[model samples]
Target: MRESAAAWGLQLARALGALWTSPNTLVGLLAGVAGMAAGARPHWNRRDCALVFHRWPWGPGGAITLGMVILHTGDTLDVSCTTYEHRAGRCEHPRVRLGDHERAHVFQYMVLGPLFLPVYLLCGGVSVRNPFERAADRYAMHGRGWWPGRS
Candidate 1:
């Protein structure tokens, strides 16, 4: 009974989180729809719980995650291990795929909701100094959860 209750609670929380983040998700969906009009393709990644739009026409040629949507340029991306290396001292950079990096962003969007864009921009926007990007890179390289609890 306790286990089932916990599962139910978790599901409830997830549904709430989706609702909380829906506004940002709407923007992502609009972008994806525009991309679709311009010949992009959308796919649902069950494992990542994200709608990925491939061949996105905008952005600087990589992947960008907004809430549950991932707009990806048509290319391969290999993220490096900077956070883990900075904290634990390792030099090996893994060849993690772009989807993994974008998945991290989705998780961030889940937590931050509408505040994600402002916070991300304030943190320096697409650089190593930005903790969000670093967290995303760490998740990509280490395959761990996106949220780094503390430094």
Candidate 2:
């Protein structure tokens, strides 16, 4: 009973977070829909709790996360990307650790909601000088906490 109650509380918190972040998520949905219409195949990454759109058109290459959506330039971005099904799609990401970095951004969107993009831009967008990106990189590289702070 205690476990169930805790689970319920967690679910409630997650729902609230989703609501808070819905605006950003809606923007992602629009972009994802555009990408889908441009030939990208959409796949659900349950582990990452995101809508992963593979083969997104435009932009050099690499993945970008908007709220709960991930627009990637390659094929699969799942942890199970080694499976035959994913390999058949030609997973071309130079970095296999991308999901964690992007997932960190997703979490940031949950916390910051509408302010995430502004903060990210102010922090230098996608550069190494960005604390958010640093934190996300740490999480991806060392599997540590992704919250922005020292180390």
Candidate 3:
């Protein structure tokens, strides 16, 4: 019994340590709070991550979803459909595409920690020149032909 208790305690401590050390987890928690405040509800879970959906308060019932800590905001964002669509229709799974992009951003957050925002801004916002955005786009577009139209 004592050995079991010690093992349980060690497990709990390890989990807490991981939580404390993980910048991605910290940023995700903050994103979760923001989503809740915006009347967004948890839509789904993917392994250690979650997806939240909400109606854009200022728009005409536009949908918004957050994956990882990246916000995919637009009038067309929806739970029923993928947030973005390729012009060629080559990518059949929109959510997966968006997830791929946002997960790459999450990796940036993990590496950059609190400096991501400033560094991203310094890198010229979300333009293709921005290394972070470029990396994400590459990850999201891997094996997929370029489709400029996303609605």
Candidate 4:
């Protein structure tokens, strides 16, 4: 019982740390709640990252709506049909995939907080020239071995 209590305490601490360090988690949770209200369900990846999968009401041609949350949150990725059916599972390489790309964006959120979106937009968003995208791409290519600051 004592060990269980200690474990629970540790888990609570980690959750608090994630919440404190990453403000995006709050936004993600809010979005996840919205998704839940719309009949979407949350899925957890191997990294324990949480994402919500929903059929977009806006139709097939709608913009990608996933991953709007800031960073360090449980519900980091928001998946629409496009992200779910097309991007993530199609990769032949285990490490390189859309999830990794999105996770990299999560890391960017961790560092940038609320400014990530604005800076990402100014840097061309997901374009090839965007540093954030490039960093994410590199992370997808190299797993945790890659990060933004390294050459």
Candidate 5:
């Protein structure tokens, strides 16, 4: 098992090296972007749900990438609700319930965005269909968010 793990690591290193040396600049760039987006989707979704609104951020995909990074690094600027408080005998609501799906959305974003976040930022924002969004929608409808009487 240890040998297999080491082999896997070596293979990964070689692949990365080849990518670094590849001549197809556009293809390499696109591949990197895809990888990052795939990795970040979960984290981004979670972060958005935990901190921001139920929808994606404004502007473009870059906004979401930035949001994921900020949230992951422990920075919460405009995040609405990320905590739950239950105070005994308090006049306010007894319990605060955070949206788990929302939190998961942030996680998704973080994983997919950072993979190639710098590229997108440097090249200016691009309008594109985020795979993460599709994933989140499916999850919300079929997974934890699904229930009787709920959309």
Candidate 6:
């Protein structure tokens, strides 16, 4: 019985994956864009994307979003390890120490509390931009290439 249940679950997951990747999904993509903007998580830069999806030692509120799951690559393993949670709903540069509590305060205000909450909520369900894609888009015209076979 358990084996059958697991197999059925896997099939359902596969179907969902296919649906998510289908071009037709774009028909309703505006909702997603609006939600992202609402969360106040406008894509800042490559690093911003990284902080959103990889930063760890997370405070309290954070969760894995579809974007992060899809964008992750093997090279980001180190950054991923360093970040405690990777889903704080707001983006900030992660640091090892609190820096006399000054930076910690900033994170608390700018990211954790009121300032960032509305935006995070607006993004709908804690989704973040995909860092790999953001980086590729930013450096697309660099000619040679930042990394081989990256595109």
- Every candidate's lDDT: 0.76, 0.76, 0.48, 0.51, 0.34, 0.30
The sequence of per-residue lDDT tens digits that candidate 1 reaches over residues 37-130 is: 8877888886667888888888777777888988888733343324434444445565566677787887788878899899899988877668
| C-alpha root-mean-square deviation, each candidate | 3.7, 7.1, 9.2, 7.8, 14.2, 17.3
Candidate 1: C-alpha lDDT: 0.76
Order of models, best lDDT first = 2, 1, 4, 3, 5, 6
Model 5 per-residue lDDT at 142 = 48
The all-Cα superposition gives candidate 5 an RMSD in Å to the true structure of 14.2
Model 2 misplaced regions, further than 4 Å: 78-96
Clashing pairs in 3: none
TM-score of each: 0.81, 0.81, 0.49, 0.55, 0.26, 0.23
In candidate 2, which residue pairs clash?
Answer: none
User: What TM-score would you give candidate 4 relative to the actual structure?
Assistant: 0.55
Which is better, 4 or 5, measured by TM-score? 4
Segments of candidate 4 deviating more than 4 angstroms: 1-17, 46-95, 144-146, 149-151
lDDT of 3 by residue, 37-90 (tens): 776444443432334343323333432222243344432222332323333354
Q: 93 in model 2: Cα distance from truth in Å?
A: 17
Candidate 3 runs further than 4 Å off: 1-38, 47-68, 74-96, 143-151
Task: Say which prediction, candidate 4 or candidate 6, comes out ahead on TM-score.
Answer: 4
